[model samples]
Target chain A: MSPFLLLLRLRLMEVFRVRFTGFFFLGLPLLFFALVGVIFSSGHPFAHRRVVMVATAADENRSSEMLVAMARFTEIRVERAATHEAAMGKLRAQIVNAVVEPLSDGSGYRLIVGGFDELFGRGLVTALPGHVELAVAPLERWGFVHYAFAGMLVFCVAISGLFGMGYNMVRYRQNLFLRKLSTTRLSKSTFVAAQIAGRGIWSLVQVLLLLALAHLLFSLPLSLVAALWTLGLTVLGLCAFLGIGFLLACFIRTEGLIYDAISSIAWPIVLLSEFFFPADELPSPLRFAAAALPSTQLVRLLRAVLLYGETDVASLLPGIAIILVWIVMTFTMGRFFFRWND
Target chain B: MGFGDQDALLLKVVIAAARLTKRFGSVVALENVSFQIEGPQLICILGPNGAGKTTLLDLLEGLSQPDAGEIRLFGTPLSARRYPRERVGVVLQKEFILDGITVGEYAELFATIQGVKGAQQILSQARLQDRAKTPLSKISNGESQRLFIAAAAVHHPELLFLDEPTAHLDPGAKLEVGRLLTEMSSEHTVVMTTHDLREADTLSDHVLFLVDGKLKAEGAPATLIDSIPPAARGHGTLEEAFFHFCAARLTARGDIEPVRP
Candidate 1:
C-alpha cells in the first residue's frame, strides 16, 4: 500500500476499536428517530403514490403554484389532462388517484377524488385548499420516520466528523505523536490526507448503513437515486464538518478543550437545523437564519430529493455551495494555523 | 519516496552551523552558537538543565529555525519547516508512542512513511521482535525509546539527532540504549544531548559543552582534559571537565547582578 493508504488503514483500525463507534453511527440515530416518533404521534397511515390529475379548465398559473405546493408531499405525483373527460378516463381506469376540477363558485380548484383509493382520496378532498397540512396525510406511519431520520443523519455527520477526526487528532497532538511523526519522511499533508480520507471512507459506510436501516427497520421507501442523493449530501456535509474538526485540532492544545468546543459548536447546529422543526415554516428572520446554516440546508436538500422527489440542480445550489465553501475555508484556515508544538 | 529533497547527500560536510540563535517569547534558549561535525562518529552535547542543548538539536534537525544565523546539513541550507526527512532521523528524549497500535504496527508505520522496507527486521534489531504484537500502551518506557531509535534509523539517515534518549531509563536499560546509539554512530554521524556524565564519557568520540545558551568548551576528550585549568587537574577527566567549566561559569556569574531572565 501507499503511505497515505497505509496510514489511513491503521487510523481506521485504531478508531474502530473504540467502544460504541458502530453504535454511534447506527443505533443512536434510530433511537433519536424513535423518540421523535413518540413525540409527534399523529401520522398518515396509508403511504403510497398519490397520483393527482389536473382538469384542463382549471386556472393556469394558480394551478401550477398549487401543484408545486402539493408536490411537497412525498406521496403526491401530479399529472395533467387535455380535457375533463380525458382526466376522468385516467381516474376511472385507476391510473390517477384524484383530479382537481374548477369549483362551481370558482374560488379555487376543487378535489374530485376517486379510484382504487377512493375513501382515502375522498378524505384528501375535504382536507384540501386552505388546510394543506393534510399534504402529508398519506404519509401516515412514515411521517416521523422520514423527518427524524433526516435529522439524525445530519446530527451523525456533524458528530462523527468533529469528534472522530478533530478531537482524536488533538489528542494525538497533545500526546506528541504528531511531533514524533514529523521527524520521519512523512509530510504534514500526507498525515492530514490520511486522516481525512480515512474518516471519509467511514462516512460512506455510515451513510449506507443508515439508509439501509431506514429501509429495513422502518419500511421507509428506498429508491436507488434517492439513496444516492442522501449519501452524497451526507458525505459532503461530513467533509465540511470534518474541516471544522480539523480546524479545531490545528489550534487547540488540549483534548478536554477540544471536546468542549466540539460539543458547543455541534449542538447549536443541530438545534437550528431542520433536525427539530421545519425551518421554512418558522417566521422570516428565524427561517432566514436557519436557511443560511449549512446544517439546515444539508438536511433540507437531502429531504427534498429523498422524500419530496425534487431533482432540480438549481434548488440544491445554496446548500452545496455553502458546504463547498466550508470545506475550502475550514481546511485553509486549519492549514494556515496548524503547527507541530515541538 | 521522501518528504524533503535529499540533495545534501552530494556534499561531503556532515553539518555546518554558524552563530545559531533561538528564542521562545522573551527567553533566549540558544545564543550565537557555532560548530561543525565532520565524519561518522558520536558527538555529545553536554549541558545542565536550561543549557540550550535541545535547542541546538532542534536547529540541526531543521525542526526550528535560528532566530539569527544559519545551519547546513550535509552542505544544504537547513529549513525551519524541516523536510527531506530521509537524510535526518530524530529520537526525542521522551518517547512519543501512540496507544492502541501494536509495536510492530508502530514500527511499520514509521518505516513505511520513511520509505524503507523490512520493519520486522528493524524491530528485531531493537530487540522488540518478541513484543511486536504488544500494544504500545502496555510496553515499558525504556522499550518504547529503543523502538523509536530503531524505527528512525530504518532509512539509514546521513545525520541522526538524539535528544537525551537515555534520560529516564534504569541503568541496564540506559546501557542498552547507550549501546544502540554506539552502534548507530559507526554507520552515521550522530549528535546526542545528555546530562549523564558516565554515558557522555563512554559514548562520545567528541564533546561540545554548553552553559546558559552559550558554547563554553568543545574538543576531543583528551584535548578537553588537557584544557582543564591546573587547579582542576585529576578531577576525574570529563566529569571534572564539566565541573571545571561549570564552576568557572558560576564564579564568573557571581560578579554580575541577578536579573529575572
Candidate 2:
C-alpha cells in the first residue's frame, strides 16, 4: 500500500476503536439533531398566540366589552383570573404575556406587565384602548427550531473537525508517532496531507449520517441541488475547521488539554453563530462580530440550502469566499506553528 | 546474496560529529560533544538522568539541531533542511506506534512509509510473528518494544537510532532484545542510549559516557573497565569502573566531597 492509504486506514481504525471518539465525534451529533428536531419540529405552538390575564372588579359591563375586544385580537388569548393576586402570580410564572386589571385609583385600568423593558411596554399600552393601561413581557422568537436544524448541521461540521482532528493531532504529537515519522522518508507535506485526507473522509461519513437522520426524523426538505450544495458547503466548512483544529493542536501540548481548548473555542462560536436561535436580537456590533465568524457564514450557507432550497453558487459567492479565506489563513498559520518533534 | 565488491574502508565512518553544542534557554543540554561510529557496531551512550543522552540521539537523527558544530552521515554533512532521512530509522523509548492497529498493520505502515519490503521477515526476526494479529495496546510493554524494533527495522536502514530501547523491559526481555540487537549489528550500525551499566557493558561494542553535558570517556567497554584501579574494581564489573571514573573526574574538577571516617 502507499503511505497515504496506510495512514488513512490507520486513522479510520483508530477512530472506530477509540470508544470516546467514535461515539462523541460521529454518533452524538446525529443524536442531537434528532432530539432537537423532535422537540421543535411541530412548529412553535404558542409563538403567535399571546397568553393574557383579564382581571376585572365591579365593572362587569366594561370588563365584558374589553374582554370581547381582547378575544377578537388574533394574537391574544385571554385567561380570566378571579383575583388580582392570582393574575399577577400567573404573570410572575410567565404563564401570561401581560396582566390586565381595573385601576385601583379609578382613573383608568392599569396593565401590569412582566419580563419586558418599560419602553416596549409603553408601546403596548398606547396600542390598547384609552381606558386600558398596558404592560408587556418579552416573547421568545417563533419558528427558531425550524431554522435550528440548519444550525445544528453547521455546528456538527465545525465541532467534528475541531474536536475530532484536534485530539488526533495531539495524540500523534504527545505519543511520539510524529517524532517517529519524522525519522522516516515520509515528507512533512505527505504527513499533513494524510491527516487532512483522513479527516475529510470521516467528515463526509458524518455529513451523510446527519442528513439521513434529518430526513427520517424531521422530514427535512432535501432537493437534489440543495443536497449537492449542502455537501459542497459541508466539505468547505470542514476544510476551514480542520485548519483551525490544526492550529489549535500546534499550540497545545497534550491530548488531554485539547478538551478544554476545544470547549472554550467551540462554545463561543456555536452560541454566537445562531446555531439554536437567531443572534438577530443581539446588539448590531455583536451581531457584526458574530457575522465575522466562520461558523456564522457556514450556518448562513447551510440554512439557505436546507431551509430555503437555495442552490445557486453565485448567490453564495460571498460566503464561499469568506470560508476559503479562512481555510487559507488558518492552514498557513498551522503550518507555521507545527512542530514534528518536542 | 550481498554485493561484496564495495570497499569496506569506504563505508567505515557511518556517523561523525565535531564540537556539537545544544542549549535550551539558559540550560546547556549538550556541550562541545564529539564522537564517531565506524562500520556496523553496537554503540551505547550511557549517562545519568538529564545528561544529554537523548539529546545526542535526537541530534544525530536530525530531529533537532545543535547551537554549534556539525554532523555528517555517510561522510556528508547532515542538516535538517536537506538531510537524507531515508537511510535511518528510530525507535523511541516510549511505545509510540498507533495502539489501535494490529502489529502486522503497524509494521506494514512503516514498511510502506519507508518504501521497503519484507515486513513479515522483520516481524519474525523481532520474535513477534505469533502476535502479528494483536492490537498494540493489548500487548505487554516489552512486547511493544520488540514490535517497535520490528517497525523501525522494516526499512532495513543503514543506521538505527534507539533512545533507551530497553529502559522499561524486564531482565529476560532485556537480554532477549539485547541479543536481537547484537545480531542486527552485523548488518547495520546500532546506536542506543541507556542508564543501565550492566546492559551497556554486555551489549556495547563501544561505549560513550556522557556526564553533565560532556563526554567523560569513550572506548570498548572492556578497555574502560580494565583501566580501573584494582582496589576500585571490587566487583570487577563495569558498574564499579563507571563509579570510579565519575568519582575521579569529579575529584579532579574539585566537585567531589572528601570521605569521612
Candidate 3:
C-alpha cells in the first residue's frame, strides 16, 4: 500500500480511538442548531422573514401593480418570473413559497403549495382574492430553521478545518512525530494529502449526519440537488479552510497558540456572520465586511442551496471565486513554508 | 528497495559525506565534517554532550541541509528529488510516536510508509507481540524504544541512523537496546551517535569521535586505543579516547588555557 494510505489508516485509527474528537465535531454543532431551532419553533419566530417568490403574468404592467400592492406588507419579498412555467418550477424547488399568478378569470391570485406560514401568505391572499393551497407543509414552526442550520453547519466545518487538521499537524510536529515520518519513505505531498483526505472524510460524514438530523428534528425538507450542492460547496470551503489551518500550523508551535491563533481568524468570521444575527441584521458598518469573510461566504452560499433551493451557477460564482482565491493562497503559502520540524 | 537511478555497482558505498557544514544563524553545529561508510558496519559517533553528534547524524540522514557540503548515497547526491529514501531508516534522538494508537498500529504505520509487511513479526522480535493492541502511551519506555528500533529496521534498509538510542534508558534497557543495535549491524549498516563511552566501546565496529563540531579521531576501537599512549590511556576505554580527542581539539583551536607546568 502507499504511504498515504498507511498514514491515513493509522491517523483514522488513532483519531477514532478517541471518540471525543468525532463527538466534538458532531455534538457542538447539533446542539447549536437544536438550541436555535427550539427557541424559534416553540413559540416566537423571526419577525418579517424575507421570502423570495417569483411572479409571472401575461402583462408585465398588471404584475407590476400586484408587486407594488404586495410590497406594502414588508414581510414578503418578490422576484419576477418570465412565465407561469418558470414560477411553477421555483415553487416546486422551494425557491418560492408560493406563486402569485392571475386567476383563471384573471380576477385574483391563487396561493400554491409551499413551505411558508399560511398566515404570512394570508395577507397576499386576502388582498389578491386567492385561496391557500398547501403542497409542502410548514417545515419550521416559526422562521425557517434551515437558514440557522446552514450557519451552524458552517460553524462545524470551520472548526474542523481550523482545529482538526491544522492543530493536529502542529502537535505532531512539536512532539517530533512528523520528524519521524519525514525520515521514512513518506513524501511531503503524500503526508499532507493524507491529512486533507482523512479530515475531509470525517467532516463530510458529520456534516451529512447533521443535515439528516436537521431534517428529522424540525421537519426540514431535503432534496438530492440541495444535498449534492452542499457537498460541492462544502468540499471547496473545506479546502480553503484547511489550507488556512495548514499555513497557520506551519508557524505556530503550541496547542494553545494554535487554538488562540486559529480562533482569532475563525471567530471573527463566525461572530460577524449570520451565526450571531440574521444576515440582514448585521451591524450596518460591518455588513459588507462580514459578507466578504470566507465563513460568511460559506454560510451564505450554503444557505442559498439548502434553504433557498438556489443551485444557479452564475449566482454562486462570486462566492465560489473568493473561496477559490483562499484555497489557492493558503495552500500555496502553506506548501512554501511548511517544515517537517519546527 | 527503491534506489531510483542509483548505480548498483556503488551500492556498497552506503554514505560519503564531504566537507559537511551546518550552521544555525551564528552557531556552527557541524563544521567540515567529512566521513564515509562502505559496508554493513556498526559505526558510532562518539562525542561529549553538545559535541555536534546529533547535528552530524541529521546531515547524514538528510533531515537538514548542510550549509556547505555534499552527501552521496550509492553514488547519488542527496537531494530531496534523488535521495535513496527507500534504502534508509532513521530514528531521531527526539523522535516520538503518536500515543493514541496501538503499538501494532504504530509499527504498521511505519511498515506501510516503507511499503512492507510484517508488523507482527517486528513486534515479536521486539518482544512486544503481547502488547500489540496496547496503546503506545501505555507501553514502558523500554518497549517503546524497542518498537522504534523494530519499526525502522522493518524494511531492512541498507543504512539506519539512530541518534542516542540509549540516552535516557536504565541499564538493562540500555543493554537490550545495545544488543538490538548489534544484531542490526550484521544485516544493515548502522550509524548511531552517543555520549555514552562504554556503550560505544561495547557496540561499535568503527568509532568516530567528534568534539566541538570537528572529527577528532575515528577508526576501529583497537586502532583508537592503540593510538593513545599507554600511560595516558587510564583504563583505555572510549571514555579516555573521547577525552583525549576533546583535549586535543581544544589545544589545536587554542580554546583552552595553556596547561600549567
Predicted candidate 2 versus true structure: per-residue lDDT over A180-263, tens digit per residue: 788888887788788778878888888888887877676665677877788888989988888889888888876756875686
Estimate the TM-score for candidate 2.
0.71
Q: Candidate 1 residues A123-180, lDDT tens each?
A: 6656555532222113235545666787888888889899877897888887888777
Worst 10 residues of 1 chain A by lDDT: A131-140
Per-residue lDDT over A104-126 for candidate 3, one digit per residue giving the tens place of the 0 to 100 score: 57655556546544665665556
Scoring only chain A, what TM-score does candidate 1 earn?
A: 0.64
TM-score of 3: 0.77
Kindly state the fnat score of candidate 1: 0.69
Please report how far candidate 2 places residue B113 from its true position, in Å: 1.8
Residue lDDT tens for model 2, B38-111? 86899999877787998898889888999998887887778768777777878877657576788888878888
Instruction: Report, for every candidate in turn, its global Cα lDDT versus the true structure.
Output: 0.74, 0.75, 0.75
Q: How well is candidate 2 docked (DockQ)?
A: 0.50
Please give me the DockQ of candidate 3 compared with the native complex: 0.61
Better of 2 and 3 by DockQ: 3
Residue B204 local lDDT, model 1: 92
- Model 2: per-residue Cα lDDT at residue A331: 86
